[model samples]
Every structure is written in structure tokens, then in C-alpha cells.
Target: MDLRQLSPTLAVSPQILPDEVPALAAAGFKVLVNNRPDEEIGAEIDHEVMAQAAASAGMGYHYLPFHPGQVTPQLITDFIAATTGRGPVIAYCRSGHRCTVLWALSQAGKRPEPEILEVAAGAGYDLTPVRPLIASLASRRG
Candidate 1:
């Protein structure tokens, strides 16, 4: 599991199998978010399967799928709602790129761009492409 810590309570990864759920729970992740839609890779990792695994591990599971260049404000809002105060969350996508991008965009004014980019870079994700969007949304923060 190529886990990358995005925050003290948040982590992102590429893809995960159902068998990894128990270890994830043991690692202290209380929530699992599927940013990848089922259509992306067919029925490879069904939501129900992940949900069942998460439940068996005593964790919460949320499926919020989005494609590249499709990370909307509403999605970010949903993510914020699903993850707030939920403890460590493990969000995954194809290569963890979409997950990381949406995470940084979700930060907006909540965190400085430099901080967001720095954290993402540490996780091996480049946020330069969405730098403009991050700046735009960040400005909307009050």
C-alpha cells in the first residue's frame, strides 16, 4: 500500500484491495473514501465490497468519485463534510493523483497554497497544474 500522509489525519493512496482494510484500520485510519468511480475499472473493487471490509474493520466508508478536471466545489464540500472530525481518512484513486488534487483544491483558503503544494510534493504528487484553481478557490475563502 503506497500510503502517503496528506495531513495528520488524512492519507491518500493509489488503489487498495479489500484484504487491506483490516491493516488500514489497525494503522489507525478510521475512514475510507473511494474517489475512483466503479466505471473507471469496471467491477474490480466494488463499493459494497470495500464498504463491507471497512465495516468489518470498524471504519466508515464513503464513495465520492470524480475524474480528472472534474473536481467540483460540491465534491469538495461533500469531502469536507464526510471527513471533518472523522479521524484519519484514506482516499484512493487510480494513481492517487485525482485524490491528491481534489484534496489540495479542497483546502482552498483553509490552507495556504504553499503548504498544500509542499505536502502534496512530499507525497510525490505535483500540484502545479491546479495551482491556478487552488489560488482562485483559496481567494474565495473568508
Candidate 2:
């Protein structure tokens, strides 16, 4: 797991296996967020498998299967609630792109646009494509 820290509370990774739970626990991530949809990858790393592993390792697990262009407010809300003021979190997707987007969107009001874009870019994700959505989410804060 090549996890990259986007913030002190949130990290992003390309993928994670059930066996990697121990390392995640050692890494101090209290929560595991699986953002990859089931169909995109094989069943080997599905939600149930990860959830079981996370639970056994004493970590919280949340599966919010986010497909491109299908992100929702509820998903963001759930993710925020799961990670906010909690221990470190590691969120994963196929290439960490979707997970990164989810993290950025989740921080719509809490973080400004420049900081959000910078953090995404620093972690090798391009938020330019989601500029409109970011603006919309940020505007909703007012």
C-alpha cells in the first residue's frame, strides 16, 4: 500500500488488500474507506472482505462505491462524518483518483479551493475536471 497523506486525518491509496489491514493498523489509520465500485475490480477486494479484515484489526470500515460522475451529498456527508475528528483514515480506489476526488469534495466548505486543489495535485490527482462541482459544493456552504 503506497499510501499518501492528503491531510493529517486523511490518506489516499491506489488499492489495499485484506492482508494489508495489519499494516494499516500499524500506520494508525482508524478508518478504512473503500471508494472503488465492485465491478471495476475483481471480487477479491470487495467490501465484505475488507470490512471483515478491518473489523478484525479493530478499525472502522465504510464502503461508499463511487463511480465517475456519480458522487452525491450523502456520500460526502457519510465520509466526512466517518473521518472528521477521528484518527487517521486511508481511502482507496482503483488508482486513488476517485478517492481523492471524494476527499476533496468532502472538504468543500472546510477547505478553500486553492488548498483543496493544491492538496489533490500534491497527491498526483488533478481536480481541474471537477472545478464546477467544487464551486457548487463550496457555494452551498453559504
Candidate 3:
């Protein structure tokens, strides 16, 4: 798992295996957020397996799957709530792109644009495509 710590309380990674649950728990992540739907990854390691692993490891699990480029505001709001609760958290999706994008969106109103962009960039995610949206969201909040 290539876990990238975006903030002290938030991290994002590519799809994690059931066996990786222990390491995740040991690393101080109290929550596991799955951003990929089973259909995208097949049933190989479905949410049930991941959820069981998370449960056994004593970490909370949340499934907020969204298609690529189809993230909704409700999803962002849910992500924000989950990430802010009992974290540090590790959210995952295929290659972690959607998770990173959602993280950036969720932080739109609460954080500065420069800080959000810098953090996303540091994590190997470019937010230029959604920068305008982020700015708009921030302005609405302001």
C-alpha cells in the first residue's frame, strides 16, 4: 500500500488488501474509507472482505464509492464527516486518484487554496482540473 499522508489526520492510498488491515491499524488509522465500488475492482476484494478486515482490526469502515469524474457534493460532505471523525483515516480508490480528488474537494471550504493544492501536489495529485470548482466551493462557504 502506497499510503500518502496528506494531513496528520488524513491519508489516501490505492486499493488495500485485506491482509494490510493490521498495518493500517498499527499506523494509527482509526477509519477506512472505500471510494471504489466493487464493480470497478471486481469481487476479488469486495467491501465485505475489507469491512471484515477493518472490523477485526478495530477500525471503522465507510463505503462512499463514486465513479471517476462523477463525484457529488453529498459525497464530499460525507467524506468530510468521515475523515473528521475518529481519524487518522485512510481513504482508497483505484490508484487513489478519486480519493485524493475528493479529499481536495472536501477541504475546499475549510482550508486555503494554496495549502490544499500544495498538499495534493505533494501527494502526487494535480488539482488544476478542479481548481476552479474548489475555488467556487470556497467562495460559497466564505
Candidate 4:
């Protein structure tokens, strides 16, 4: 897994395999968030498979799948729900971009947009396309 820490509590990664869960758990990740849609991959690495791995490893698992363009307010809300207070979370998608984007959107009101972008950039994701959406979300926070 190419894990990239976004914050003390959250990290983003490229799609993780079922066999990788135990090692991730051993490495201190308390939650496994699968952001990649099942339709995008085979059953070998689908959410159910990953969920079972996470369960056996005693880690929390959340399967919130969505395409990058399909992200909605409710999705961001759910992302926040799954991530907040969940010890250390490792969210994954195909290239880690979708998961990183979800994390950035979830931070819209809670953090400054520039900081979010910088954090994502440091982790190797470019959030330029979602810049306007981040601003919009932040504006609606009040």
C-alpha cells in the first residue's frame, strides 16, 4: 500500500488488497475506509472482501463508494461521519486521488481551503479541479 498521511488522524492510499489489512492494522490504522466503487474492480479486492479482512484484524470498516464526479453533500457528510473520531483512518481508492478528494471536501468548512490543498499536494494529489467546489462548500458552512 502506498499510504500517504493527510493528517494525524487520516491517511490516503491506493487501493489496498484484502491480504494487506492485517499488516495495516499492525501498523496502527484503526479504520479502513474503502472509497473505491466495487464496480470498478473485481471481487478479489471489493469492499466485502476488504471488510472481512478489516473485521478479522479488529479494525473498523466503512464502504462509502462513489465516483469522483458523483460526490455530493451527503457523501461528504458521510465521509466526515466515517472519519471523525475514528482513531487512525486509511481511506483508499484506485489511485488514492478519489479518497484524497473526499478528504479535502470533508475539510471544506473545518479547515482553510489553501491548507487543505497544500496538504493534499504534499501527499501527491492535485485538488485544483475541486478548488471552486471547496470554496463553495466553505461558503455554505455559515
Q: After superposition, how far is residue 40 of candidate 4 from its true place, in Å?
A: 0.5
| Candidate 2 minimal-lDDT segment of 10 residues | 77-86
Q: What would the TM-scores of all predictions be?
A: 0.95, 0.95, 0.95, 0.97
Q: Please list the Cα RMSD from the true structure of every candidate, rounded to 1 decimal place.
A: 1.1, 1.1, 1.0, 0.8
Clashing residue pairs in candidate 1, if any?
Answer: none
Candidate 4 off by > 4 Å:
none
lDDT of 2: 0.88
Q: Which candidate achieves the best TM-score against the true structure?
A: 4
Q: In model 3, which runs have C-alpha deviations exceeding 4 angstroms?
A: none
> Across residues 1-142, which tens digit of lDDT does each residue of candidate 2 receive?
7887899889999989999998899878899999888888777888888899999999999998998889888988887887787789998988899888888888787788999999999999999999888889999984
Work out candidate 1's RMSD over C-alphas.
Answer: 1.1
- Residue lDDT tens for model 3, 50-142: 999999999999999978778888999899888995969999988888898888888888999999999999999988898998999999888
lDDT of 4 by residue, 1-142 (tens): 7999999999999989888899999999999999999999999888889999999999999999978599987888899999999799999999999988989988888899999999999999999999999999889993
Task: Count backbone overlaps in model 2.
Answer: 0
Candidate 1 Cα misplacement greater than 4 A, ranges: none
Misplaced by over 4 Å in model 2 are: none
Q: What's the best-to-worst order under TM-score?
A: 4, 3, 1, 2
